[model samples]
Target: MTDPIPEGAQEIIHDTWEDGAKRSAFYTLDGQQVGYRSWTAEGQIDMEYGIQDGVQHGVFRTWHENGQLCELSSL
Candidate 1:
């Protein structure tokens, strides 16, 4: 499961489709994006994807705060 947005986030960008699917990116207070998540209309995670052009790109992944891999996939 994707973690909640961290506290002291400096910025956030969010988009929602007509069908209710949503995507969001979270950044640290210092301005580096720390995470990305997407969810279906029903609120299930559609994917945990990478960021490019302020959106999901080729592959999706999640990482620990200490930089360990949490999850990764093309889907």
Candidate 2:
């Protein structure tokens, strides 16, 4: 494994990758599964997201790490 993701270390996301693997993603902080954006084996974005500091800041798109479509918001 390149970088082993920690369990409940802060985040836990799951989905199917285009290459075909039960893909999973872990976060950078307290471990809350910050986001989930992947396709099913059948092809569908099993996307998920979360809020930061009480505002939507993570996983804004069905596309993980690419929420470019979401409007830029300020606190």
Candidate 3:
């Protein structure tokens, strides 16, 4: 199960490469990214990480809306 989008996520950005790889960013109303996810052309998750100051830097994690942990990594 995928996590539900965070409450108050006001802006989202999406980018797709020529190869069909995709990246998506979720942001707060103030424009701070709270989460990000990227997938390969084959539709496999390359990374699902968090952001601070528009940079991936901290305890990156993914979880379901029910609070099940899917993945975690520190950068």
What does candidate 3 score on TM?
0.46
Report the lDDT tens digits of candidate 1 across residue range 35-67.
566555555554454444455445566655455
Quote each prediction's TM-score. Answer: 0.40, 0.29, 0.46
Model 2 TM-score is 0.29
Top-down lDDT ranking: 3, 1, 2
The CA lDDT of each predicted structure is 0.54, 0.42, 0.59
Q: Give one digit per residue, the lDDT tens place, for model 2 in 1-75.
A: 112223344544444467756565535456344333344455444443444543445334443333333332222
Displacement of residue 70 (Cα, Å) in model 2 is: 12
Per-residue C-alpha lDDT of model 3 across residues 27-47, encoded as one tens digit per residue: 554656766766555555555
Candidate 2 clashing pairs, residues 3+ apart or interchain: 9-31, 10-30, 10-31, 10-32, 11-31, 11-32, 11-33, 12-33
Global CA lDDT computed for model 2: 0.42
What RMSD does each model have against the real structure? 8.5, 8.2, 6.2
lDDT of candidate 1 at residue 31, scale 0 to 100: 59
